[model samples]
Target chain A: MTERTATIASRVGLHARPAAIFAEAAADLPVEVTIARLGEPAEDALDAASILALMGLGAAQGDVVVLRAEGDGADAALESLVRILETDHDA
Target chain B: MHTYSGVGVTPGRVVGPVRVMPPAIAAPPAGEQREGTTTAEAAAGNLRSAAAVVKEELRGRAAKATGDGKAVLEATALMAADPMLLKSAVKLIDAGASAQRAIWEAGDGVAAMLLDLGGYMAERSHDVLDVRARIVAQLRGVPAPGIPDADAPFILVADDLAPADTATLDPAKVLALVTAGGGPQSHTAIIARNLGLPAVVAAAGVGELADGDEIFVDGGRGVVTTDPGDAEREAASRWAEQVSRLAGFDGVGRLADGHRIPLLANVGGAKDAVAAAAANAEGVGLLRTEFCFLGHDTEPGHDEQVAAYKGVFDAFPGKKVVVRTLDAGADKPLPFLTDATEPNPALGVRGFRTDGTSPGVLARQLAAIADAAGQSRADVWVMAPMIATADEAASFAALCTAAGLQTPGVMVEVPSAALTARHILDHAEFASLGTNDLTQYTMAADRQLGPLAALNDPWQPGVLALVQATVEGSRAQARHTGGPGRAPKPVGVCGESAADPALAVVLAGLGVTTLSMSARAIPAVSAVLRSVTAETAGSLARLAVSAPSAAEARSRVRARLPVLDELGL
Candidate 1:
């Protein structure tokens, strides 16, 4: 598994447009990815491709979350997901 | 014909088939089992197909939508096909629940989770429920619960509209809006005004109207007539003609006899200033400075403040821009300036009172306004809000002078200020009647509360009496300071009341020299004002102020104004 961590940068947090954008990007990637708040248990991780799960995660702006992916292109997928999470969509 | 009355928020008349927004879907019965030997796997399969259909439908609509509407529709579409929701529903189906019950329970579970997250996340729960309803409706082979899909323009009647629902409304498809609940200041009314759609709110019994029912809605009069006669249809047609003929404001406001009444726009920030200028507003009457300090944790620095104010001032190079200093507290509390835990923030340390706690904030803001004024060609006049006594007005005027800004004024929002306008005007250069707050303080009604909407109305005789007193006091002060020949110190109204055409006429008669409102209201007010002379307006004002109640005052003044009918106001 390839893992990466990024802090939310959208002013309104990882919800609405930002969450939708991130979920769509993750779904289009080759590897299956899961996300969890940094301090949350691994078992509490949610499917990163699901907008519902991303919104339900309630990761506000400045919150740090961990992303884990598994497959041939897992490292590249994690890098892309981290980039999406760190960019401010509101701006 | 059954006639219902409500407060008309926007003006126009339309007769159309009604489309009642479907209510929220009912929760499926608990412990319901799949019938007729339908296995859990088959029920799960049905749920998936239903979800797919709902998703496709939303996706199609999303493709056709643009901007914010497109984003909202796309988000909802994603919710319909969310794997988390499908997984939970399949689990429920495995426990012997029907497809409808399974999806409903799963949706609720997800919604509850989102709600638990709080604030912005909590609002998304509504989107989940809306998606769930669509899926459930698909499964049942029924119409989805929301704004009905209609090919022709229709009147939309609802108990009240949620913000999400109102946001996606297509104005081309909706002729008018009628609601059983909500007041003039409700979200429905505001959205309808922005869209230029005629609307009536707080009309009791409108909820009983069925789809396809023909109704005539006179938005200006707030009357909804079911099974209307030929006369109503003719009236609607007349309204349509008048609406088409209503030209843009020609950059001036005058009575029939050529008495000039300067029309201005109440703007929040630089964007609104630009829009107002595009709409040909003579000037900015109330430049609410709260936009700068609202979201900040601390006072914005002098340069940042100057830049923000300059953007607005630059919009109107030679026009008057009355800048109201930071009105922080009550409905608009700032994190750094206001006490969040006040027992009654509205009556607490708000507006001008904030300077007492944070002394330099107002002074800094004034200096910034002065700095911005110096750089721009706009005639910037400053005012402070919620000043009750003459001493408060005197202190505020002194602050403006010390900051090197001239033409300082005080808002006559508190009843005391209006009653003692003479003394207050003695200290200040001018007075602006903030009718919304003036009405609120006079009637002892919270403007935000729907039940008090009647009392909070600016047309209330008690409020009008105070307005007349303010004008009288201003006149008295002008006479004392500069003899009877000097014009009354430019008393203007910067409030929602100024937007109402009939009320605007009455205010003009009451000696208000200027009327400031939303830019969209300028054309209608300018038209209505030109239809009556100053003497006619004075008589109408007398009729309104003499009435015992707000309803009486409104009806009396409207009855005398035949121009309202001609213009379909």
Candidate 2:
């Protein structure tokens, strides 16, 4: 199992356009991916696509979160997700 | 019988079951969320489903109102293309959040982003009214917005009222309204009160009504009689029948002998323009220019405003369009406005009083009207606001007249001006009562206060007295001012009161030649005209002005005829 923490960088956490973009990215990944928050009690922040879960982690503009993937493309998937978050899509 | 309460919009009585459309819930369809395979994918799937649901719901509403569903589709496309929500949804799973929670949080984030983008769009230039468009899209559910004469009379139950929904509600037939959610500040409350639909809100157990259940509602008392007793049903029946029987009320507003007072619609947008047209308003009395200014940073150039203004102008060909020039300040802020931050924006610079800050704003707004008027020979009237003394009205009117917009007028929202209406109207072409703010100012009560809503009544004798003052002022001006050739331009009620048929009669009685409100309010006003003669309406206005309390005044007016009672007076 490999896990990496990433912060919620997008302004709107995930309800609208951002949800579609990220969903497309993880559409065909060959790994089992899960999400977690630093201080949450393990059950609160598990669903990556669930905007509410990510917000429950209390992640604001700069709060970092953890991402984990286990399977063949785990490393590549993690890197891509991280790259998407870190690099400003427009600004 | 089930019961709930909302503010009474239009006063009318009907016997009918209830139609409670569900609140446009913000969940995605289940299928889209099922698309996710991996744990992260699963999270994305949930988020997609939620988005899909909201999209579908909004799309259905949008499709009903416009061609091609332009606004909803845009919002949906933005949602579908959103990467942030999906990312956060997956991250939520990684973070131990339930898939549902992740989708909600992510959507919130994205909404914030879009709002920011909308703001950015406003700052960039004036093209689309992005924020207003979003609001319009959000409120697009009222297609046909008109309720059919239900096979049986019925009340409407909704979570909240949107402007469109209110626009569609049939005042002629509906009995009353019971809404689950709405505050005093909600447009639903305002429109409900305007329409006089006996309504109640915040009542417990009113939300459980099954479709077609019979109930009796006392809107004035906010009481619901579920499975109404025979007495309640009898009273409701008598009321509905009597009100319906008093139709074909003769003549427009009349004076002592007989003079037709023009009743018009106060329109703010193209939608309102269309609604006003449908309502058969005599003309557009108060054409707020701000609707065109919506969603733009810089003032809309002459051509842009002209196009929108022309749409409204064309809505009622040959009728008068009372265009108020760049009245931005406080409550209705413009992106281009400078130095607008004020603790009490209402009391601060706004309306015609914004001159010292920037006369150019007024100039541009007037210029736009002039440009719009250039296209046709329609009778277009222009006006200004916040005129306390005669000088302000004179200056604003002069500017408009200089630009070729006719019938420059002043809105008597300020108490002092309403009292000295003659002095103000002496300098301008006409006057119109801004009763909502006028009442608020008269009582010094915050009209927006939920608890103090009862005191914000426009019919309060004090407000009526102020209205009387404006009438006296305008009447005196009509006699003394206008000079040899020009007849005193007609004064009217252009606030919330004018759209209300009951209040329309009162205004006509009070001596306002015109009554204007949301285009949707025209029919109700016309109905009031059909219900009573101007002499009776004038008599009612006088009583309304002298009565000690709003309730007392309203009761007296209703007592004049059983028809009023039947209309749920």
Candidate 3:
């Protein structure tokens, strides 16, 4: 299992176009990834690939979230997701 | 014949059969039962296939759309095919929930979650609800939510139209619009005016007009009548014909003595530029930049802003396009830029005032405008709204010049701005009076308040006095700025006031160099301008400002321009 924490860079947070972009990136990964608020329990996490769930996380701009991936290339997937999360889609 | 009265937001008349839009879909009962194994499997199979079908339909529509419309349709398609939603529905179906009810409940759950998130997320509630209704309608074998298709031209009667529904309306098929609800500022009225469709909004019991029932809608009089007399029918047709003629007029707006008053359109986005061009507007007088900012989680980047700006500027090559910078605050509180709540948002930070708290936003927008201006053929002019002092105008003008925008101006919406227009225009190049806000601010009446709508009238002598002051001040500033052989600094009227043909003449008489309104209003205003000389307009302006009240002022002007009654002004 590999996990990484990143702050939401999108001015509007992890929602709308930003959430869609992040979800699309997660969906393209070979490993199944889950995301949750940084301090929340893993059970509260949502499938990173699901746009609605990702949006329902209510992660606003500047919020910190943790992403965990477990599978082949899990480390690479976590790295890629972290990079996408840090990028401001609104900008 | 029964008749109902409301406010006429859009002008003209039409007689046609009524077509009332169906009400929204109701949520399915939660206690629905699915049959045993085989039946449950069949229902699940149906739900799966129906999702795919709706997704495909959305894809087809998405392909046909452009810009933001294309993005929205594509996103809606994604929501329809969401794997998470499918799995949830299947589980509910296995738990004795019918397939239709399961889909409705699952979709509604997600929509509720989004709505709970609020702000931008809550705005998506409508889209989610729309997709849910579509899938449920498919499973139940019923019509989808929204306007129904008609075989012929008819009057569209609805409780009120959502922005999405109004976007898809076909003016050729919908001869008129009568709504049981919606104030003058509602989306329905705005769309009706933009489309040049005759509309009577807030008409009580408009929904009672049965489908295929012949009705006559007098948009100017705000009356919907059934069984009109011969004279009324003839007059309605004549009025329609006159409006068409006015709409078809391709000439530049001018007075009887050939004093040119460049009639322009006030557009919210690039899509409206096409309509303004079709209406033969000399140019865009007020291009609102809020469309680029609205619904976004954050401020749009330079590239996106430039693309949006260039779209409108390119549409009117060699024509003037006056763009107002992002005027967000108060009524349009941007979460990222303003406080969540204010005791008096109307009097609080708004318009150009956002510069204090959100510095880079305005600068980025100005930079984008400058970049877009470099790429387009249109003459782009930028302005700041709600500027009250010459110092602010000077600073704004300085920043605009530094950013390579030479023609910077300020909106005379604030009473102080109007009172000191001479000094403000000395720093800025021109002034455009936004009478809606000016009247609202002058009369201390909230524009959104229906009960005070009468008090918000632009024809109020107090508002007219402010307008006259701005125009005279602008003329003085223009002379001071020009050493010799230079035209005076142009002061224009770009508000609902400009849409009133009688007031357009009065505005011109007050030395307003231009008139900008909805594209549909251009023709009647142009026709009125042709009948009145600049000198006559000046006298009317005098009579209007001297009156004690808005009603008295309106009547005084009307008494002088008897031709207005003939033109259905």
Candidate topping DockQ: 1
Which parts of model 1 are misplaced by more than 4 Å? A7-13, A38-40, A52-64, B26-80, B83-146, B162-166, B268-275, B287-314, B323-375, B382-430, B440-456, B473-489, B531-535
Residue-wise C-alpha lDDT for candidate 1, range B151-255, written one tens digit per residue:
999999987776566656989999999988777766677678767788998888898999999999999989999998999999999888888667488889999
- Candidate 1 CAPRI level: medium
- For each candidate, the alpha-carbon lDDT, in order, equals 0.89, 0.62, 0.84
- Stretch of 10 with least lDDT, candidate 3 chain B: B447-456
Best by TM-score: 1
Candidate 2 local lDDT, residue B242: 55
Query: What TM-score goes with each of the models?
Result: 0.81, 0.67, 0.77
Per-residue lDDT tens digits of candidate 2, residues B368-437? Answer: 7888777855688877767788988888878887888767888888899987888887778788778877
Model 3 misplaced stretches (Cα beyond 4 Å)? A1-42, A45-50, A57-91, B22-66, B77-122, B129-146, B205-207, B269-271, B274-280, B314-319, B330-348, B374-379, B443-452, B475-488, B546-552, B565-569
Across B402-445, the per-residue lDDT of candidate 3 in tens digits comes to 89999999999999999999899889888999987898899898
lDDT of 1 by residue, A1-91 (tens): 7778999999878888889999889889988899999988888899998999998787889999999987799998899889999999978
Decreasing lDDT order of the candidates: 1, 3, 2
lDDT of 2 at B298: 54
